[model samples]
Target: MSAAPLTYTPLDPSGFEELAAARPDVVIPIEQTPAWIGFERALGRTPLGIWAYRDAAGTLVATASFVHVTRRFRESVVVINGPVWFAERTPAAERLLMDTVREQFREHPAVDPLYVRMQVATPQAPATGPIEHGWYEREIVVDLTPGEAELLRSFRPNARNSIRRAQRNGVEVKHIPREEWKEVFATQLFPIMQETAARDGFQAFDSSYYETLLTVLGDHLRLLVAYRDGTALSWLITTEYRGYSVYYFAGSTLEARSTFAPYLLLWEAFRVLKAAGNTACGLTGIASENYPGLANVTTFKRNFSKNVVVVPTTYDIPLDPVRYTAVASILAARRKAPAAARAAARRATGLARRVGRGRGAVGASRHS
Candidate 1:
């Protein structure tokens, strides 16, 4: 039988949510959710719209949400962890979805994107024609279906021992209410994040970004803090949608190392998410050649589960050939130059810090 013709159409919030709910077993990526649109806006990106492909029979087949990011001289539309498929997905359907979205952006009155970068959510073979772009090469997801005891037993012996040691040290993990986020970020989470960034050699986002994220995501977000002797030791942020949860953001203090507070915090997170009926929790991305910054945390996360998941690579579709090619060339040179300079600066800064007493300094790789 021939498939019914599919038409590209705007998807309202209610329809988007209903289609997402249709696949209860599949965990929808937070980037493709309606809430993500608000998040992009909060981050100063231009929200295009959420769209879907519907068949003649009116069944929604696939959907995606787009956000326009204008960075300095470059402008591009980004689709992270989408376009989502609600029915059996094929290359033809995927191609049609991508083509139609590009058309939509081209016809958009407000902006003309230099290119569109799409990171497909489904794991099927990637569609052809778009230039392949890659971000975090792999991620780790843990199954929460097993009973709590079994879940705890599944972790590496080291991870299990750390959790136990944290408990023995009188460490406690607690969830902070949304009403208290601002103050907590200022007093606890931000300081811990700074410490973690310094120890790990990375720059942390400003507190305003997290404040806005908590404000916008609201109940869909959760903050878990590990405490020992009435002092904050470690903290984690997670976001839940449908039946899926993600280990969104996290940090710890030097004091947390001895107590193993992060370990207990993760164990408690598993129990809390399972109790809330989430069947899977994405530990987000792991260490990869392209993103070696994750090395430290990846080793930490791997002690919990080894279910490494390889996600689809991103594809870039050029809308304006002239500008796209020019920008691509400039970006290639720009990337190498800045990276070398930054590495040198970091080394000098690290040495200076050792000599004296100085201090300094999302998407899949972004948040991970």
Candidate 2:
């Protein structure tokens, strides 16, 4: 008998949730969920397309979510960690997805994407070559299926101790919903983000960026904050989908270091994920051999799970003639510019500090 024809349709929140409910065993990343798409939309990004196909039983069994990002008018659609489908529906879903995406580029004036970057979350669509657009290649996935005793035993000795110590020392990790978090997030946690970015030498998003993030993520997002003696010490944002929860980049105050608040924060998140019936939790990106500075961070992730998963290579497949080459060339240039930019920034900051110190000394001597 021939395979049943699949009808593809745009996915709303309810439709996406229906597919999510249908695929209980599959762990679709939160980035491909409806809340994430809505979050992107709130940030002024266009949802290029999101489609789900119904199975013969009339259940939504497959999903493909894409977002349009325009950088200097070089537009592209990125399928963030998904194009999720059941194993049986892979072939039919793949054909419909490719056809629909191509149609969007060709016919839909609003979706004139220069390229399509996809990393299908299925065994059927394995990626190859270099990743053009992605957050990380390797991520740490911690198994949460084991009992609490087994989970603690799996953790590194130091990690286990830190969690105990944090609890004993009155360092609390609070799971605040979005609405409740607003009471303290701006005043207590926002500055920590800037401090973390500066200390780690990374560029951070604007203050307004958090508005889109917190508001649009809805219930899929969690605000985990570590506090010591009534003072906030660290903050972690976690997102859940299906049976998977992912830890995003977080911030920690200098005062939190002595208390080992970061370690405790992660443990709290792990506990919550396990209680939610999640089988695994992603410790987000970790350093491979390429980034030496991240050795310590990778070691921390390893404490919880020895299994480090490398997502398939994200390839940039061109759809347009004019902007694809332009964007590719720009990305190539940026790949080589980071180290030089860091060096320049350090030198400028050092010079500015010296100048300020010299002026301060001169003023002191004159006043005396």
Candidate 3:
């Protein structure tokens, strides 16, 4: 007996829902495509997506998209995120699709040093050697399977205390209606984002991008806002996918710190997902050690959730050796420059503050 031949094609928008239905166990949601499309639209670019199908059978088996990002170091890299496929497909099929995608890029003169970065939701790790990259540990999990009481008991004592304190302080959690909340988001959230970005030396999504996402995803998107004494304190944006809820984006006002509003917000999200029959609550990308005070955050999330999943940083599969080396060199330089600039800025600010205080004291003595 021989296996059926496979055919590769470009994925059409109409087939997205059916494809999503075929792979319920996979986390690649229908909205992910639209969300990527939205990102391309906002950025004014078109990303290449490759879909694998059985020859002439017309039934889709696997799908992957390649997004090309031009780095500051002048390197052209492609990231392939959320690659979804039927469980029945063999490892050979996945390899074939990847090879085809690489060849397609090679034919393009402008698409030099094509790199493939993937984060699969499946538990089974794919075999390596086709790409020059190392695999870090990754995970896909379900939390609601344990039930709510068990979930609460798993949490760290401080996390449980924070949640209880928020509830005791009369913190209210509610879904912000898309229409009414858009205006508040623009006014209240944008400034905080701008300040945070400036302080941290990173860029954030433009206000319009978030607005577009809300309109596109509709009910599948949920905005959990926490309030105390009629004042907005903290909020989190979650997306429901395949019987699981992912806590994607979050923000908080400084006033919320004292009341521990985020703890209640997360707890409410967990309760809502459990009631809706969702099997898991994904506490999306938490740093194990990098960010300041993030260990505390990681501990907090782990208390209510048993799965402390550490997903790999994206893996790069370089198609062109010369181009890949050039890009890597440039990225190393770009990262170093930022740290140098931040250190210089801190020293300059310290000197200016000292000079200003000295001048002010001398003038005050002269006046006296």
Candidate 4:
């Protein structure tokens, strides 16, 4: 009448696929893992992954992974992203895994102030234990079960108008073949992304990383290109996760903005999701608070659906509160310095260019 003991193992890259398939609810897809891995690689960081196994009477009952974030400023938190366990073993397995992770984290000085962030896609919140609590995170979800006409009617007036204008203006939208799209994206979108990142003060992934993703996800990933009068205007990359399709990335030319090519591209993506029998679409990563231009972005997304779910921004549980705060403040300051420098550089460059142009004009007039 004794309970069975639990076992823990370090999850290797090879084992992830099989484990993920065994328990879909608790596991994120293989494609998602690569994206995260690619993110870490690009940033020059590595995360630790620990897998939990429960066996009762020599029979395997459950499995889960404890993922620890490894970064210079944010090294203390170990996020338990997508832990999978069988339905029958939920309570016991969850408790055991949680306890083990807490103990493990306590022993390691590197992992102080440990916290696990888990996202359940359903509208209803999951039960939380003594160690865990729920926080609000928002996402704009569009129900795709309805026909195209119904879907269009569900949109707000502005969204509908934009869609109409895009259609009327003859902005053609279609899926680009993966191989061909890769080439086009590398040549056309990469430079735009680099410029945007430079202006916005962030880093962007290299083209090879995106190409790898498109190759792995295949049909589940789509590249929607918007064109007007035989000229490419904008493009959007979408990925399907579970029953929902997400608008992952998009890029548009300055010319495209005048014709509202992005509006047409998004409408086409939604239509494609509906046609493919997806249940919903996710307008991902729109900031809800404390950022300029975020409100405009949020408002634009809100027009498409009534179900606006806000996701919690990234959280931190500091181990050394005093030290952590000091480091965090320093990092924040570092992030701002680049933007200020970029702004100053731009102004100086503009002034120099204007002065040079005036001198050139004056010289030409004198010669004439």
Name the candidate that leads on lDDT. Answer: 1
TM-scores for candidates 1 onward, in order = 0.84, 0.78, 0.74, 0.65
lDDT winner, 1 or 2: 1
- Error (Å) of candidate 3 at residue 318 is 2.6
- Write one digit per residue (lDDT tens) for candidate 2, span 294-339: 6656876887788889864365556664456676677778877997
Error of 2 at 92 (Å): 12
Question: Which regions of candidate 3 are displaced past 4 Å?
Answer: 1-7, 29-32, 53-61, 71-80, 85-97, 108-113, 120-142, 145-150, 192-203, 288-296, 337-368
lDDT comparing candidate 2 with the true structure: 0.74
Task: Give the CA lDDT, 0 to 100, for residue 67 in model 3.
Answer: 60
Worst 10 residues of 3 by lDDT: 121-130
Which residue runs does candidate 4 get wrong by more than 4 Å? Answer: 1-47, 50-102, 105-136, 194-203, 206-209, 215-219, 290-293, 318-326, 329-368
Judging by lDDT, tell me the better candidate of 1 and 3: 1
Global lDDT scores for all candidate models = 0.81, 0.74, 0.64, 0.63
TM-score of 4: 0.65
lDDT of 1 by residue, 297-340 (tens): 88988998889998766777667766777777777777789899
Question: Who wins the TM-score comparison?
Answer: 1
Query: Order of all candidates by lDDT, from best down to worst?
Result: 1, 2, 3, 4
Output the worst ten-in-a-row residue range by lDDT, candidate 2: 122-131
Candidate 3, residue 359: CA error in Å? Answer: 25
Give candidate 4's total backbone clashes: 7
Backbone collisions counted per model: 2, 0, 3, 7
